[model samples]
Target: MDLEGLKLETERLLLRPVRGDDFESWAAFCADPETMHFLGGVQPRAIAWRAFLSTVGAWHVQGFSFFSVFERATGDWVGRVGPWQPEGWPGTEVGYSLARHAWGKGYATEAAATCIDWAVDTLGWTDIIQTIDPANTGSQAVARRLGASLRGPGRLPPPYENQPTQIWGQTREQWQVNRLRLRR
Candidate 1:
């Protein structure tokens, strides 16, 4: 994909690949228990460092990963949101995980919609999915707001194989239709 130095912008957010400087904020976000409740519990700085490294590696190796999101107005590191699909993943996914402080502002929906457009148009993906725990009503609302439908239950690869998840999805055509709403 040659996404070198790729950066995408939303109305209130600036999205880019994770940088070396982002490790600290990313570690803090990963360490937040409340924020990590649905994300396999909070991790220590050591583990967060590994995850941060993996995130950076994915961009270079897989040519894509969730972009580190920042608030345009404040430049605060808000979260990560973008295309992600590792081995055994159900399908091409435009996933999201924002810090607690960044919740309830429609950033997930806005950032996801932007990524969905890129995934469909640039990646040439036919479909997209988001694996969310059933209890995560916030994410469900965001999926609905972005016009995806609940496809059914799903499971991830080992390590997270046992985690309960529901697959929400839509197609490229569906996103084009949904994009109309965003434009309106």
Candidate 2:
């Protein structure tokens, strides 16, 4: 797929591939302790750059990656949301990570929902999963809002083997049923 001009736009957001300019906000987001609480830990600037490269690299290697999100109204970088699955991932997953200031605005649910549709339709994904930390009620709520159910406990690949997570997901058929329930 030629992703050169590809982008997904919601009523309030603009979703597109990660860009070099997005790194500054992306780094700041990762550097913040609160925002990175459930997303590993606060990464230093150098580590954040490598992490940024990984997402950008995923697009080339996997042909798809999380979209860097920005509020259409103000053009501010909110965070990222979309497809993600590493070598030992339990299943195809659609995840969200947003800035602290972007919280409480329903952006997570919105972006994840959009990503789910794209993944299933464009990527031919049969089922989608989200490995969420149990203690992160905020993300759990977002998952619930998207009509995903808590399937069971999930484990990540090495380096994060000890971190706990709950697998949440639904089949493509279920998503069709649930997607209708959402207010467009």
Candidate 3:
């Protein structure tokens, strides 16, 4: 897990480590009420900066975090998606968030599926989860598209401990079977 050299590409996206230059788009995403609705509400610019920095710090401390996602054709910062497991997290997770404008294009699924594969194959994770707010139909759709099944209610760690979520996921064995079937 050489964090600096890490990068994952899908047909329409480039997922890589968060960089200083990404703050603008990151802040914009954080400020959007719709985009941040399930992600702790709209954050002020200053707060968003702290959140952005935390993602950068996670890569240094944990060797993995949400990778900043970019549109391949336009080189626009679209969002962040990938492996994440903070202290007290429910499980090893692959999460995604995209700017509002990037929505409806299946970018989350594309980026998340790649991250899930890496977690299972490269990181040797036995299982992975996505803690999604139940009202977030879009994310639930992405989870379903990835072959994850709802495992019932979940809770976030402190600060966000009260927020209700649903755990959706699959075991590595299950993902492998799905992958093989997908290729068929």
Candidate 4:
């Protein structure tokens, strides 16, 4: 499906396609060691540029990719969160990465929940997974908050295959149940 026109908005965020002007923020996010610790370590600006391009390419090639998250109140680029599944990936996934400053405000969970809803409700996915580094407790917590349970070990596709990761996820049915509970 064509995702060029897609835009997902939550109370505090605007989830949309990555734009060329977002490069500086994206590069800075990639270069922050604290933020990149679980995301393949800190990358140089050049590497970050390529990674940014890859996300843009995924939108064209796969019709889905991480959406650039903007804080609605401040109009700031806070991060990226959404569906991601490259060739040989562990599973259809809804992933998230936020700039260091964006942490602790529930932005990750809020944005991820929106993405998860879209993946299941719009994309018709049966299940969604999040491959998180075991040491990244912050992300793990976000996954749990989203109603995902530990689904055991997982491996990244090439280049990142050696990294230790764990899968956390739930079926669409399970998510729907949880989503209802949250509203009540």
Candidate 5:
């Protein structure tokens, strides 16, 4: 809730609210072939930017939303990572997407861990879910690494003709347990 005032920092990323000016880079990332692999391999720049705005606008209305992710070291827009609760979903779900070049570097894991920590520790979120395209094994691996247990396949009907996704999640209790184990 109140996404505007929120900011989270991880080892290599800073999670901040997406702004109007970020549209260009965000669009480029969303439109890139490599980066859009899981998003049906890219869309028109206008379409991507409009979608991004809808997401941000929803945050304003819903009180919780995704944050634009930036690589702290290089200060570049790496993409977006945050909590997503679409119309049909059961609970607040964690979602993340990054530029293609940022892959294989552990940034997704680090930023995601930080977001999950904040979700449970500060935001009082209970069940966190993530639906990763079955073909995006890299994202599925990141989900697993973040301690989300696989919950099986999910389908997004119509307009979104993507491959089936594998759902993964962690309850607040599970997140706490994992945190404690890490501390130990």
Candidate 6:
């Protein structure tokens, strides 16, 4: 996939490719315990920047990477969302998080919906998994809002540290049905 200028625009958020310089703002969000609860734990700024750059670089190499989400009205960085392949998972996963301040505003759902649309419409991906920490009821709610069905337990790497994850899923058939209904 030629991903020169890939961007996904939602009603209240602008989803764009993460650049190297987004370190400071992105790190601030990641550095928080609440925001990073499902994403391992808080990390040093340097580690956070490196992780962000890894996502940026993955965009070129894997044709997809975690996107930086910003509020369109205020132009403030909120969090990240996108498709990823966890170490042992067989299919691609739709992963996301939002700053504590940006919570309850539907930014995560809005951005995640756009990514789901792209996966089904543009990328021809049939099945997408959303792995949420069992304790993260907020994220689980977001997954449900996107029409993803619970698929059972999913495992992840350290930091996650063997926490049991609930896998929510959306198939192409389900997405297509929902998309048509959305259009109507």
lDDT of each: 0.91, 0.92, 0.91, 0.92, 0.79, 0.81
| TM-scores for every predicted model | 0.96, 0.98, 0.95, 0.96, 0.90, 0.91
Best-to-worst ranking by TM-score: 2, 1, 4, 3, 6, 5
User: Which is the leading candidate under lDDT?
Assistant: 2
Worst 10 residues of 6 by lDDT: 175-184
- Report the Cα RMSD per candidate: 1.1, 0.8, 1.2, 1.2, 2.0, 1.9
lDDT of 2 by residue, 70-170 (tens): 99999999999999998999999999999999999999988888899999999999999899999999999999999999999999998888999999999
> Each model's number of backbone clashes?
0, 0, 0, 0, 0, 0
Better of 3 and 6 by TM-score: 3
lDDT of 3 by residue, 1-184 (tens): 6777888998889999998999999999999999999999999999999988989999889888899999999999999998999899999999999999999998888898888888898889999999999999999999988889999999899999889899999999999987665445
**Which clashing pairs does model 3 show?**
none
lDDT of 4 by residue, 1-184 (tens): 5456778999889999887888999999998999999999999998999999999998888778899999999999999999999989989999999999999999999999899899998889999999999988999999988899999999898899999999999999999987776555
**Which candidate has the highest TM-score of all?**
2
lDDT of 5 at 95: 83
Determine which window of 10 residues in candidate 2 has minimal summed lDDT.
1-10
Error of 4 at 8 (Å): 0.6
Residue 66 displacement (Å), model 1? 0.7
Candidates 2 and 5 compared: the better one by lDDT is 2
Q: Give me the runs in candidate 3 sitting further than 4 Å from their true place.
A: 181-184
lDDT per residue, candidate 1, 1-184, as tens digits?
5455688998899999888999989999999999999889999999999988988888889888889999999999999999998888988999999999999999999899999988888779999899999999999999999999999999899899999999999988998998899868
